[model samples]
Target: DTAVSQTPKYLVTQMGNDKSIKCEQNLGHDTMYWYKQDSKKFLKIMFSYNNKELIINETVPNRFSPKSPDKAHLNLHINSLELGDSAVYFCASSHLQTQSPSSNYGYTFGSGTRLTVV
Candidate 1:
């Protein structure tokens, strides 16, 4: 089973349009995050939810909102989308962090949703 999944793998819309993307995870993790990958492939965290509470990234515009109905699900809504909003969005899940030289900083990420604003 996929640890994390996101819908509408590809999206193309005109500027000023509104759209939404949905995400879910079955890993039973309490923490989930949204990341945006710009054209240059710079990844930045947009939002995070821990046990259904929102932790917004202050740098993110108010046009973007994240909602978590429960620990296993998180969804994003964007309003007044701009041309600069074109990018790939990814959803990821992680639980406990164990620091060991051999242990991978554990995280499972979903296939990204590519959004293009024209």
Candidate 2:
């Protein structure tokens, strides 16, 4: 079974439109997050959710939002899409645990959704 999955592996659209990406995990993880990879392949956290509780990155724009209906899922919604938003969006999850390599708990990222705003 897949640990994590995301929809719309690729998205291409014009600017000024609103779009959303869906994510779900079956690993029974409590924490889920949305990460963005820019053209330079630099990854940055955008939002994190645990049981519907939202923790957003300070550098994330207000136009980006994450919604989690349950602990198993977290989705991202972007409003007024801009060209700068063009990047690969990844959804990931990790079980809640202390910082320890023996925990067997680490982030499992989805294949990613590539969004292109022209």
Best candidate according to lDDT: 2
lDDT of 2 at 88: 100
Residue pairs with clashing backbones, model 1: none
Per-residue alpha-carbon lDDT of candidate 2 for residues 1-118, written as tens digits (9 for 90 to 100): 8889999899998999999999999998899999999999999989878864678899999999888888888889999999999999999999875567698576999999999999
lDDT of 1 by residue, 1-118 (tens): 9889999899999999999999999999888899999999999999888874677888999999988888899899999999999999999988744466465456789999999999
Clashes of each: 0, 0
Q: Give candidate 2's error at residue 47 in angstroms.
A: 1.1
User: How accurate locally, in lDDT, is each candidate?
Assistant: 0.90, 0.91
**Global local distance difference test of model 1:** 0.90
Q: What count of clashes does model 2 give?
A: 0
